[model samples]
Target: MHRRIIAPGALAAASLLLAIPASAASYSPGAPGIGDPYYPYYGNGGYDVSHYDLRLKYQPTTDELRGTATILARTTQDLSSFDLDFLLDVSEVRVNGIRAAFAHSGQHELVVTPRTPLAKGTPLSVVVRYHGVPSAKTAYGFTTWHRTPDGAVAADEPEAAWWWFPSNDHPSDKATYDVSVAVPDGMQAISNGTLQSTSSRLGWTRYNWRQNKPQATYLATLALGRFDITTSTSEGGVPVVNAYSKNLGDNDGAARASVERTGEIVDWLSGYFGPYPFGSAGGYVPDTTTGYALETQTRVYYSPKQFANGSNTSVVVHELAHQWYGDDVSLKGWKDIWLNEGFARYAQWLWSEHEGEGTTQELADYVYASHPADDAFWTVKPGDPGPDNQFDIAVYDRGALAIQALRNEIGDKAFFTILKGWPEKHAYGNASVADFRRYAEQVSGKPLSALFDTWLFHTSKPAAPAARTASLAAASTTVAQPKSWRTIEATNDVHGH
Candidate 1:
């Protein structure tokens, strides 16, 4: 997710009728939520999803989406009833092939009462059938579904699965997915991971995509529209597939120029962040009014506006960096968003250095000097910016500044080791800011609590180290400005999500 700059401004249940378990005395209802303070109702407790098999059909004419979700999970506790985060009208629900009683209890919860009590540690299969126009369903007074001129795209941060499928809807519960969407034969349905097959019958075509790695529900996405798709292989042999809306107006070439570099960017990023963490890599641009681009798992979502000025590979670099930091090792909760945005924003600075635009220190010094100590930007702590300020510009720019400070304090060898090693240590799972701090200390063999407290936890500006202050002070007195200095800073203007 790319965060826009703020110039002192910013942005379950359970039930069962069937045979009761032999030890039915312990069976109880699952907690309605997973208990994240930021989003208490985001994911349900008592179950851990392992996979989601989604069979869907969409019609552009009516904007109707029909889907059947087969979920595979294990009961963490004996469940008499459980909840699946979802919206839309559910026509039928079955648990273990037995008809289950179901109803909508809250804004997005689909509560189910299975015929039989579910025992702890037992594998379970749940099939849910439903159809609705996603554009018409509103939650939190907004809809993540982007209705386009050709079709629709499902991509957003925090929550998107509720608009399409049913599952554990939080980053903490990562699961593999097999998403199959059938659209008109002339249209295309794009999603995460690699394309397995495409079959057409009558007037509809089914596009099957499989994601073998564990993924958060919000990262699972589907895009249906008329697209011009390109296929290639990266230098590292990673399969690359990119698509663009055929009617992208004047930004078609720029969009392609940026997105087509996915293969090259993935390879370049792998040198620092380790290997690309998914089976395939690519991105898509659909003609939608969404103001931000999203790092949706394997296939990132780019708004047409991202390329309005010209080809913008910086945004691509930010999103692909997420393929490792955000997508592979996700946040344990929303409060740790800096783990995703900070690392991504920092990657852009690294890219600028690689392109001979500016060094990371030069960029960091510029940002640190741009915002005054009295500015509100410094008041929003990146480590635990509350929900309302979660996407504020400070979370990105100031967050990256914190990272640069760490590098300075720990030296090059230990800092780079922590960067590559942190992801490898927590790959395909969720982690918190505290977890990252501990890991960094372990690798650097330094007491970093003071550093983290001053840079991340504190709501006040941190005093600049003498070396950093002298470098920026010297650079400021240079006869000529650094190459691409303005361009690197201008990237903050392009908003993302």
Candidate 2:
């Protein structure tokens, strides 16, 4: 069933106006909850994810992947238990290591309900091993490859995490990960956090990575290939590492430059905003055609395109900022996605400020000039339809402008204080717009309700004539505001226009 039904209130009008019989549309099996679309469930109950050890037996005639995963999660609710949303290419499922029945809800999600009620916090482990050619159309976006120009296609981006593991399937649930990926003997695997160990058995190599800290499901990643490893240290003394293909061009020098610059950006951001909330920070520039980059915990996966010009600071800064906003203090749900992307975008602007590139007003002007004509900037409610819907320019550029407005209202000291205090107060957790608003009000010692309400929830941009005039007046006193004949002739520079 893959159809959406209208409400009862509209049924009468529809029946009266329509002459033809209306066929009942099938309900989408794996659709998310009514209120929270991305993450349907919520609570303090944590999840333990594992059981992804499987051998990949590839067939040249038919592109397919044969694999399995064991997922162990505990919840406080116990009403004969409920189902969790997972994205996978599964052939078989087993609960408590025994074959269990399961059903596919939609194109992306799977629902497996245990036969018996498990106690709250009691470990309930399920192993799902499947064999199929991974698809790029689904929510997980996991792509299985038979062969590529470089070698076997490595799962990359928001899709790769689903290639092997079954998780909460979104950024909401921050869980602990113990992942062991077994790849062909020649291929090396890279994932989040410090490398625990690697052991070669038979013709396969198993690489182990344990992320003890709380991490969102999307940040979890894995890459397989023969990689050339390079190591460095941050100014703040955090270990920086890079994993690029031995087949690609000279990546060590670019990786070193990227690592050094990344560390510098982290340090700069920490000084203004707080410590780097994550344990370590680095990049993994894989030799691939994918143009996008993901800020996956301490390790960011960058495509070869990002390193084409030696070091892409924009990409580096964007991902580095996520270490604080997205990875450290994530949004409570998809509704508040701006909380993650908006903050990161604003952090980029702050970086520009630190570099003495332009003033905040100039940046605001730039964003305002580039603002999309669609009223969707402030009107599109969260939890719309798909993940791509959440990545609109409004959430990134306009969202940053909204934050910049607040920063301008409150001085840099207070604004940065709020930024530092936000993740520090809510470390390893989730937050909403209301939570941020309250914190900003407390830190800035000003009533920011009107400000946030006008920018965030309102449909139109706020009139800033008074505010602009004040800014211009302040700039004239401290710095040069542009000299003009009309302003110079006036006794007082203040002009009413």
- Top TM-score prediction, candidate number: 1
Q: Which residue pairs show collisions in model 2?
A: 51-70, 68-129, 91-130
Clashes of each: 18, 3
lDDT of 2: 0.58
The digit string of per-residue lDDT tens for model 1 on 339-422 reads: 999999999999989998888887777777766678899899999988777778898988998899899888899999988888
Candidate 2 vs. true structure, TM-score = 0.76
**lDDT by residue for model 2 (423-492), tens:** 8998988888888888998889999877776566666544546336224221222343322211111211
lDDT of 1 at 51: 94
Clashes of 2: 3
The C-alpha TM-scores of every prediction are 0.93, 0.76
